[model samples]
Target: MSADEGTTPSPLKPARPSMTAAMRSSSFLNDHQQYRPPSKPDNHYGIDTVVEDLQASSINSPKQISPFNGIPSPENPPTIVESGLSHEYTHPNCTQPPGLTTDRLIATLFYKSTSPRVSNAVGPSSSPPHTASSPVRASSPTGADAEIPSNLAPSSSFDTFPLEPPTNDTEPLDHIYGSYVSPMCITSFLHLMSTFPLPRGSTNLTSAHRCLKLDAASDHHPQVVELTLAPAPSQDYLSLADLRKHELIYRFEREWNIDVVLRSDTLWRRHPRLVVFDMDSTLITQEVIDLLAATIKDPPDLAARVADITHRAMSGELEFDGAFRARVKLLTGLSADIFNQLRPVLDVTNGVRPLLRALKKLGVKTAVLSGGFLPLTSWLAGELGIDYAHANEVVIDEATGRLTGEVKGRIVGKERKQELLLEIAQKEGIDLEQVVAVGDGANDLLMMESAGLGVAWNAKPMVQMEASARLNGESLLDLLYLFGFTDEEVAILSKET
Candidate 1:
């Protein structure tokens, strides 16, 4: 037979009805416009496999059925089938509910439906039967006459799905800052908290033995323990600034080298926009101008006189601006190469390099403000990769290549240091609270007082007494702990380059 003659419709297949009568009616297209055929049936028997896997996991792994696995309680049992065939399963342990089982697995995959039309949407009869697996299956509803699961009956009220376990997303923000007068000792953290008086205005501690809430799972630092202290109901909020007012705090500082660091939890959480430093003794061990005066070629005895003047100025015996001018005058007619000669003698303080590298990784802007001259400060700033440097300009005569004794511009003493800090903070679009100032002299006091956190690094008595914190240790890396950074964090930041 020919190909056309051989082709015939199967006897089992029904012919599609013509739509000519319905098409004649105007509302026929509009009325059935919202009608849609059911989705294609899922041609897999994965549900049986999932049920078997869950059964195996429950039996093989006892740890998987942990009581604290964030399952809901039995007092309000979860609906398993919702097909009116309600059954409750109690574990033999009875201490808690067993973790997800085959029934719960099925419940999770098949949501209960209130509408009869969708009630049996995914049941056995909805698709072709599977011969490979013998899993329990419900019958699908057939047209308006077909029955839905009785348990899936419509209710006036229904519970939404159980809420997911609380996450660690808010963990970092939930931390409480702790402050200590001295460097935190990891070994003595818990001991200190227990022995010391509760942080200021802890009126709630009357009933409780401890004032601070120590988080057992805190992972930041073992030495710098994370804690939370609720504000006293009747008293004003306490801050690190108010630390000195309490006699107990003073005793802690004097006796144990410990003082409460207030609101320390918030420090260094966000990267600061600017960090200002006093260049002389802060960045380097020796004062730059004093070093410059010592290295001047033309002056032999000038170093001694200038050294004495510098000591007096740094000790606050002489005013910085006048004393600086006097010391600069002693270098008059001296070759400008004095800075180059002192360059080899310059000693960067311990921990300066690592700290600066870490700060650079964090994208913090660093600058040095000094009463010393620019030639030395500029060179040091370049070596340290400092973003900005400001200092006094020593006028040099082009013919002699020597100092003329007259300053070319404004002096960068205490007042100017404060001004530069303010200008840098403003230019960088950061608040004063985001700025950290470090110094080691009486002249650095003004700038220190103006910054958000002032660190007196091996400073004179006056600077130490007034600054926010004092670091008597030789290492500058200790500053990391003050900002709530652990050793691990510093190490991670170190490798970024």
Candidate 2:
């Protein structure tokens, strides 16, 4: 091909050394080579520059670029950037085959190019890269765009994303209830959230509303405030499930001795028709069965045995029915006179009177559903003006004035408790959703599930897991606050009474 004669370009050929091989050599030099002060900026450009230069020079003299081409083999492998994106080195001998455009060649050389704008997207080694020019992906079905910061996406190092308010207007609403021990000042609650944010949504930060205080004396027993938080951009709506999944919420609960309730506050205000309470630990401080067994002839030994059985039953380790029968047998021949003696020790839990009074004011029915005997439950219900009582009966021998060691009625285990809840709900002419059940033992779980809203009051682990809301702090009156009532409203109602 003489210079004077018009010569056609030789058909393009694949480079002698693969692009990957060239990239590896370049990376090796960059990593291991000592920097003797550079005379010019390295440009820090990677594989693409070499490829373009090679293609350009290949148009003139292809043979001269071969010596520089290094085939990447087992002895010399490609350097993989930890970010999962692979970069390749280029050689002038590496000329694209005929008909392949530069974009097509780059697309083939790299595994597969998604979009041209992706080149502007940064990999681990690339700095000051711009975001893809393309519009962001559409918002999710939840109307929240989970846009991960470009800096965070490549390396995969992140604990959480900072939540912003959702720009969209159609998201469902949610509220977070933060409750603590009495006299919980509004400022204290705010400080707690600022210190350890559980909900991390604008709704929680901006829409906080003080709910009714459970202990009417806010000056002394101010317990809680309800904050109606708005959804964050990443999360269109929050739920109890969302709160539980966050580690900060659990930490907030443990650290502050606070109980958090995330729910639709509106629905709970409808007022429960029947608020069924577990007689043992929930309504009263002691387990009636354990208390009864403590009065046995061998007080220490028999009480220990009965207490062990009671613990197992409440913890859900042993079946309540079998444990109940076994416990009653242990109390065989125990004097019935002990009931009178034990009556004084039957401490009605704190806030019972006020909670009961409030329920009565609202014309809401109340009941005591117990696995314990009627002797105590019936008496307590009557004491508190409870509308109904359902419990096992301990047969008393008139002649001896002692327990006959037998239960005369059906045993009220978990199933019976649930059945009684349904019975009470049906009798009240209300739907199941119009009932509230509070209990602390495993037996109370089914009844809790049966009710519209279940309150686990200082409950066992299992009950806590299953219940709708949990109260770790004291005061059954906390129920009113949970119902979205304010201290002023409760005070007015108390005055009306």
Candidate 3:
């Protein structure tokens, strides 16, 4: 089948900005350069498995919310200004029954629906779903006709507020996005909701599992939709829910071509004040060690040996410090000045500049905490204008001007990286809850866990499952949506530099 000819389009799917592998050539492009392979890879896993430093990851899903995941109702509507680069912590326009706690999920479900199963016309022209003051009764077939479980949450608990379809603006949009599943799959969603065991009982598709409050996120840019999941067991992540998410999300992604990332609501509201990155395979494309190994003249297989060790270390199969030391020992007599040759060829990951600019606009401090050696790490930090840089320092022999293959002070292993993160946060006076760390390997896990949000960027399956969140979109800028920024807001911030 042709790339664009998968499922039949729905009236609702075409208006979204998200698209498939075969993106339409933009009229705005230079006429000679308009037909390049689509910038956004198809969300389908087949072609999205791009060759990169890290292995293609295992499945990523939203962090499951536990029964204890409840928050207090706001005294007033949250006052937010998301259209600009404002760093305010306000969340606007939430109203639920007065004096009740609610479990929230800031779901960033994009418009990937493209099912052959047809539904009645629903588009930008349709009215927005009703708010809490006038919530429509839960009406999905599974909810209205399911076998009410014996241990379901009291229906009265969730009946006060009801779930509604996400809202969209009325402006007529002209662009057509690619489709994934039909909105009709909300049928499958309702079924999963009932089967997902709750703390007190089951969802049973009852009113208590209703979606209560809706966020005022931008509806035009294939937006984020925040909902207050009334009667949810807790806000904490649960193992069973995550296992089910892992087992099912992969199938749904492959069969239907959708992306579902679940994150714990633990750091949901805290916008970061500092962002840290692991340099190799994350901020930049290549592993510096592998590059060093390729330069060895005496040993023809030096590159292969070091590459094997580095891969194992990053994969969590080998202890990092031993793996790092083992690789460095192979380079006992290399000229340290090779860094100059290496520095010029390093490729920064796509979206680094725009993400940094947005963070800078928000007055966030930026850092690079790499496990590789430097002057290269420091050089990358300087090139990117990052505020702080830390990495392993190779000891140079005064007699020969070659690397002694020994580290100078302390090794920047996983534990050391965590310590550096805390030190940087303390020096900046930024609270731990306001720091974000991004990386692709096991060494990054500790620092990521300590930060307000830990983003696993095209991570290994192991890292994806452990980090605070996983990012697999076409570009890293998709990260802004995790913080509730819309695509338009991201576009504006990306234009800064």
Per-model TM-score, in order, reads: 0.54, 0.56, 0.60
Task: Note the Cα lDDT for every prediction shown.
Answer: 0.58, 0.62, 0.63
Report the alpha-carbon TM-score of model 2 versus the true structure.
0.56
Candidate 3: Cα lDDT at 231: 36
**343-381 per-residue lDDT for model 2 (tens digits):** 788888877888898889899899999999887778888
Better of 1 and 2 by lDDT: 2
Scored against the true structure, residue 339 in model 1 reaches a CA lDDT of 77
336-436, model 3: which lDDT tens digit per residue? 88998998889888888898888888788999999998699999899888999999998889999999988888889899999999999999899988888
Query: After TM-score superposition, what is the CA distance of residue 258 in candidate 3 from its true location, in Å?
Result: 3.8
Best by TM-score: 3
Error of 1 at 238 (Å): 7.6
Residue-level lDDT of model 1, residues 338-406, one tens digit each, is: 778888888999889888998898888999998888888899999999999999998999999999888
After superposing candidate 2, which stretches have Cα over 4 Å from the reference?
Answer: 1-206, 214-222, 231-248, 268-270, 397-401, 495-497
Task: Please give the TM-score that candidate 1 achieves against the real structure.
Answer: 0.54
